[model samples]
Target: MAENTRKGTNTTILINGQRGAAYIKVHKRRHIGYLGASRMMASSTSPVDDSTPSPSADASLGLTKPTTHLRIKHAPFKLMHPTYLEDDHTTAQGTQWHSRASRKHLYTVKLAKVHLDKPSTDAEKATTSEFKIRGELRLRTCHPHSLLKPRLAWDISFWVAVWFVCGSAAWIINGFLLFIPLLYESSSQGVQAAAWGFVGGTFFEVGAFLMFIESLNSGHEELYKKALRSILNEDGGTRKQERGKLRLFGLAPFRDIGFLGSTIQLCSASIFWISTLTGLPGVIPGFPGTSSVAITDVFYWTPQVIGGTGFTIASVLFSLECQKAWWKPNPSSLGWHVGFWNLLGSVGFTLCGAFGYGSVGNSWMNYQSILSTFWGSWAFMIGSLCQLWESIWREANT
Candidate 1:
């Protein structure tokens, strides 16, 4: 029994010894594995330091030593094996740092408010204000070149002179025609013929002159030049449309001056012609020819002549108003002043007074004759003279 017991104890001791050896081996191997893993992790976490100086620093400040304390973190997985992982991480980090540094260098911190340090002076303020006022005036007024051009001035002067001269001539001719007939043996017949001629001639002359003036004042060339300039000057800038409305429309004061003048001329011519045509006997009671003509005819002819003179006076006054427009300092207003007045005079004298008078008296003696023969002629003559002075002024200025 003792021997068997001893043998069991020996076997137990051997088994325990074998178990101890195995545990020691496992512990040592585990420690060695942990040590290897730690070395790999430490190397992976460490950063590479560059020995080159930063290019962004000023070279004039002197050369700077490369920084050595700088470190970069690297991945452990890359260190475990030879691979392209380290290269990619290095390139990406380098690019990111370079971009960040560039951004920092681009911005400069300005320490002073430079613009606030300067204040405007009184002279500068005055100059700026004056400039603004001048600019506004330029925008509102007509173009300088357009107004000052010699052609426009010449046209205005020519038309005005023509109207004045023609109107005066018509008045003088009508008077002559009416009076010459009264000096002959067949006074009645001679007067009648002269009267008809006077009225007819006035109408034809005035109409022709007016038509000519209208043709000359077409404004086609001026408009074409303006349009051409606009097209050539366009260069992606904002453009404003130009206006083509007549200047007289805006200038109300000068509106009726020409009309008044023309009316005077028309009335004066009509009266002289009608009186001559009717061949009313002289005031002598025993005078030769028929007294059958109505008393209305006697009174009518006299008033017609008187009324025409009144209209002529009014025309003279209105022409003075037109002259005012021409004298304005603004050159742009000059053309308009001349154009509208000329138009008014032309239409009122020729078309309304002269042509219109011919259609009156029913080819013998009509109501229109009484209205036009005296008043129209007188008005035209006086108005024309007034315009004559205005033209003279314009010419002198030129």
Candidate 2:
């Protein structure tokens, strides 16, 4: 009985020890699993926390924090998995996340929104629309020919007027000084009038010549430069061509007038000096000459008397040419009003020639006086008319 009892007790004790060992094994396994789960959660959360600061702290500091910690979650499984052992990726992500987050926290802030009301007044809107319309019109109207032609013509005309006015003034002053004495002696009212008319006419002629030359030179230079820049096959400025034709065909004859005037002045100057020096009979047939058929007579007669008729003929030809230039078949060519004035000039020249022939005794004097009177009166009247027309046009346009 005692042995059996001892054996039973030993058996029970062995069974209890086995159960305790099993229980201890289970408890250790459970504790190890919990610790492993906690370690894994801590590792993941640690990297996330390191990457992003607390949102409340960021907001209070007026910062914008980056979510770089999220990048690790998006990385390829092969890199995150143990099989790949992507040590560099892990380190790089951690570093980038922390740096980006810190910088964002320091500087990033939200921008304030701005709202603007639309224009309130009808008048303001209308003004804006008008300005826009005008701007569009200006842009659309930027044509080369339309823009350049009028401006160039105006410039050329201005220079022409300046030269004409200056030359006219010079001629009048010089002629009056030279002719005052002769005017008193000539009892023939016609001769006296012829002398005064010649002086006045010469001034106008000189002005015309100077103005023509200046206009031609400036116009030619401008046209030449413009041609170089113009498209190879295009018709550029025709003002140059028209002006050139006028210069060659119409104005060329007047060049003779200039030559005649220059010669007369030279001869007159020479005679006056010679008479002062030689102490010869100063009372020539023509006060400046010894006889009516003296050196002075020849000098004065050849250009002034003879050339005057030639000048008139030239002026008529020029008027016709001007008509041709301005009144061509093309509608574009018909704008210039200068042709009418040129025609009028021709008429004045013809009338002057008739009157001069009747008044002057010398053939040369008759020719010169008439020629001078025609051109002078014509240019003055036409130029004045043109000026008036221009002023009116400008006023109307404005």
Candidate 3:
């Protein structure tokens, strides 16, 4: 859309491609998710009183400019991951929704200023023209430039997968030990099972904590953005205020599905610690005692229920983050697969928590709960393995 500003003329680009041309993955318009060109309405908090004016349309779309041929904006879009924005003078002067996906699959969406390619026909001295730009969409590693890089073994994803795998494996064994009555009847085996559960729960808490921390700087793109700005020094606004507030704790009530999911998951893991740790034979005085069902319920069962519920919510949010439609699976999306299994595990854990409550002496309830735990742990392990595999081979087939 064309509009006049107090200082100069500025064009408000909408995502629908009504005013300009937009391309996904540099040419592939048929994306699997809601990855779209990003546009931001002018905000009162803009660092400067004046917004960056849209460049005047020349006889050509600045193809003659020294900066190189094309004047179009390139935005990388990842259909499999949550959307984020990276604003730099290299593209434009405003924020836009973008994707910075895998190394090989660095799918970038380009929004070109086709209108500015020609001089206005009825001009009294017109600086801007009007035209609809069009381009084919296709995925290619040789082109579609992006700043995103491949994952490393020491990255947050790797650690998260490692911890989850260990934790899930431990829980699987613990569940099995309790599920079999003969094994559980032996006091030594029961004690050992509790010990294993404690270890598993500890590992879960650590992994969940890491995930929440990772979300603080989701995708770790901010660091790269800052690094690039140090060299380019574009826009002249290097102050912290102009860059935006520190998102160390994930600001706002409810933004970013991954952030909310990780936060909830972390809290759940922490709360569940109460049951796993205290239930150890010597951790607490009244814990692991057959004498009082009420005490066991208070310390163990209650926390499990609360944690399980939280985990379920988190898992759902995570799954939702990976989907365009909540009911349908994203074809060929590894992130979606990871979410699917985690959601299944969350459901199992929820059932386990529900059945494990009330009477500690109910054999039926115990068996059902243990069975749920065993299945849930297996599901969790599978998801963890998938994540690990994805993290390790991010650029393999991208």
Candidate 4:
């Protein structure tokens, strides 16, 4: 079988069997609106009407039975999409856009089998004829995979990175404030650092939510298509597929790597809030959250360790979405770079958490913890910057 996916009026999938080639011509534009408060349009080109002239009317592809099983899988991709193209979801038509907001107009675009009708002539039946579609005939079929992807465009996704950059930059500022004569030499600085962290955590929460929403919006289409197909195919004309689309709050992300990553990141930020809020000098009356090293580690350091661990786990999940495979790295892709730097930042925080324990017992441990926070905060800043660049670079060239 031969396949051509080049940009033009007609794309072909060739299978030379008995006589010659079997052809399907695809071209149409499916437009959608309301992507992150913008009327940003996404256009897709699919086969509108079967334009390929049939070689002979004796044998032709027709939809006589439910043999057409619309299956969707990544054409040449090894990451993200490969996860959703499972057997249970093959007919499910589960597909999503590039999380970075590229491929604004691209969707699942699936194709089921096209059965050839029985040949009218015995001679033609013996010939093992290939295929042909009449010019006036119509076949509403999905492709093997999405062959055209538009370049990344400006969308709600760009701002998702911006918020992340803001959040990371705030953490960097707090890290800088930590470099004082002693851990809490100046209560004012300790309070200042806590304030920075709180601000940063707030920003992180916002970014994570927005990122989750972005991924959710993209994923909704898969369910939407599945629901529509259900009605047309009469699998169950009920609203079961329609009801599946309503995944509010944080319930839907578990099955989605991207959504799950964002949700975890959001939870990590919330955990940080516990430490940041309690660490303030006057946050609570008699309870000295950051006032004394003798007890500060109990309230602040423990949550720091827990939250840092959450970040590490979330980073791993995010990185997995971009890696070529679990053992291989994909540094060429912008999504990979975003995950790479975040992974580095998570590492720094993990080291900080390790050194942060029993700070009062050892001066070296105290100094190392502070040093790790300083470096880790800056690494986070770098990662956020990379994300910002990626959000813009997601421009589609298709």
Candidate 5:
């Protein structure tokens, strides 16, 4: 048996591996039980180091306190990451921590109390307070109605008047002239009648095309002014965001889709009208059924084909735009009807051109070519009138 010993608040037990039995005693109490040799340790106390700092030392440096929560009411700068600043006691400084998911929001930390060896001036404190103020600008969304103005309405009215008066009168004259060739007995009289019809058509088409150009320019100018106002007056203006540029045949740029489509259709029509001039004065002076000099070897039907194709493409694009406009909430009263009429006119023109092509191929389709052309031209003129009326209605109501 070993002699018993006592230590400070600790007791030791020894186990015999052969018997697998042990007895432990503490402060007048004893435990006798079987024990496992592997579970017993010879030295059980953990070593204490004298170099460890006490709780008082940690508290003195303000390290024991929990992190304070800060509510940033409004902030201007969008924080990207957690920003750290060295603790300075002279002036109030904040640290901003941003969440990865949200770029606009941030958590800012303002230390409650700081120690400073030197005193701060009034000017320095004022500057520090100014830095604490935060704000952000919320921009108003753009709408089509926002672009409309009184002056713009007046401009649209003036142009619409010009288009209707000239375009309508030209259509009336051409309608009467188209039937004259059938009534006339002389072939020369028919030629003269066709020449006069072209003259009237050219006069009105030019007027209508000019008005369309003016309206487009007016729209672009108004929108540009609106864009400028947005930048100078609104705080949320993003300088980098800009409108799309429109280009036609590598010339000056525009932005309005309606304007672009109309311009293309009119330019193609101008080309179509110009082609009619080639057939004029067929037997110039002395030459019989031939030109004095061979001006162009291209077939008589080539220009019509090319010009008609251009007109068809422009009409299709414009019709699509009209369909889109039709679906818009609270569109103009005449909007959908205008689109329908224009689409019908375009279809007629396409059919007319196709029939003309068939006639050139010496097909029996030539029998109906004049009738198709006459009706198609009339439909186009009617659609142009509807466009003018729609503009007038808008000007009066809007």
Candidate 6:
């Protein structure tokens, strides 16, 4: 019929006319680690006619059958107990009740049927059912939704990026190092490098394509557009504003920095692969002649310049992403540090290409060019390995 609760304790009184009896409910907060206090309700029948039972007497009675009429009160001295006042409260009525007072912790409110010594009537059973339903609703309100997990497509894209880097290494080692030197001696040697470059470039392209897809799937594109719209005031007010340039060269502006970098890198791979095809022996026929030499010099060195430039920009972007904390830095940002090596490789390749074209017969110039290109490839390989480590670390931490 009535309820009274102190700051730390709650008491519920139930009055029943069937047997002219009463019931009391006492709920105390307890600290039991992650497992919230049990939801089982203790029912007890009064052994003596008292407004509130004595501590020693209540302890002696333990838990008894709950009756219809009751008067519940807090034990003032129990405040000294460790679990006595830790922000917990419980209340129940026809169809509404709540427990666990503190916002700091989440506790599920559940109702367990309190078995009575005698068979319960329809009215009592209905009351019990209402308690269960209300308790379940309260639990749902406590924990609304589950946390989002990383998607499988994102993971797949990451692995593809890894493979793309590996392919680049294979292409450099097999195609350029092993095959390119023997180009004038035998056209067949060029085939090995061409095949490997194709394989490597294909993987790189696939990875880059997947990155684009993942960016869309992750909702970064829409976020970028929303940000653009806000900054540009695209909704148009009383003042007319210039239209924001959200697209570049008729394509969506790449708001995903990593994806943009990867796309550029893919373009670099394509140019370099195309260079491999053009420099093959059969492409020009008269191997060491002036015209053939001129063609070879132009075709072979030109793509390196373009590719190196793209790669340099991409490496810088990747490094910036690390600085921005977009990609979790691997223990003091190993990936960021590793990217410097790739940047160095880009410089090497760029220099190699710049000086390579006109000085084909100049032994010293040719030597410097080959040496620089070699350094670039190895540096890029090392950077790729560092990236791989970063990806592995990210997966493990997640």
Please tell me which predicted candidate would have the highest lDDT against the true structure. 3
TM-score of each: 0.29, 0.31, 0.60, 0.60, 0.44, 0.47
What C-alpha lDDT do the candidate models reach, one value each? 0.29, 0.28, 0.52, 0.51, 0.36, 0.42
lDDT of 1 by residue, 1-398 (tens): 00011222121000011101000001111210000100011111111112234553212211122211111121112111100111112233321111111111111111010010111432223222111110000001111121222222344334645555565565456544443443352333434434444454455345434423322322212211111123112231212323333232111111123333334444554454453334334542322233333443353334344533444454343334323222432223332333344334333333323332333335333333333433444544554554444433321121
lDDT-wise, the better of 2 and 5 is: 5
Candidate 6, residues 1-398: lDDT per residue as tens digits?
Answer: 22233323433333222212223333342110011112122243233233455432232222232211111111111111010111112332221111111110122232211221132433223222222210000110121222223333245435644865776586566536543564454444435654564565566556555544443333222211211122112221112222322221223335345556657776786776666566555665664335466667667778878877877887776565444233433235554655577787778777777767755578667656656766676776777676555444321111
Ranking the candidates on TM-score from highest down gives 4, 3, 6, 5, 2, 1
Model 3, 49-163: lDDT tens digits are: 1233334322222121121122223211222222332232334434233222321123333322221123323221122213223222112112223344464657665787789
Q: In model 5, where is the ten-residue run with the lowest total lDDT? A: 99-108
Return the candidate ranking by lDDT, descending: 3, 4, 6, 5, 1, 2
- Model 3 poorest 10 in a row by lDDT: 25-34
Better of 2 and 4 by TM-score: 4
Q: Which tens-of-lDDT digit does each residue in 133-174 have in candidate 5?
A: 111101111112323222324443346445545554554455
- Give lDDT: candidate 4, residue 181: 48
Candidate 6, residue 169: Cα displacement in angstroms equals: 3.1
Query: Model 6, poorest ten-residue lDDT window?
Result: 78-87
Task: Name the regions of candidate 5 deviating beyond 4 angstroms.
Answer: 1-161, 164-189, 220-255, 283-300, 325-333, 350-353, 357-363, 394-398
Count of residue pairs whose backbone atoms collide, per candidate? 30, 8, 7, 14, 0, 10
**Which residue pairs of candidate 6 clash?**
16-68, 21-69, 22-69, 22-70, 23-69, 23-70, 44-64, 44-65, 45-65, 175-193
Q: Please write out the lDDT profile of model 2 over residues 230-319, one tens digit for every residue.
A: 211222111111112224213222212222322333333233223222212343344433344445434343334343344344333323
Q: Give me the displacement of residue 93 in model 3, in angstroms.
A: 27
The true-versus-predicted C-alpha distance at residue 279 of model 2, in Å, is 21
Error of 1 at 266 (Å): 8.1
Residue 136 lDDT, candidate 3, scale 0-100: 20
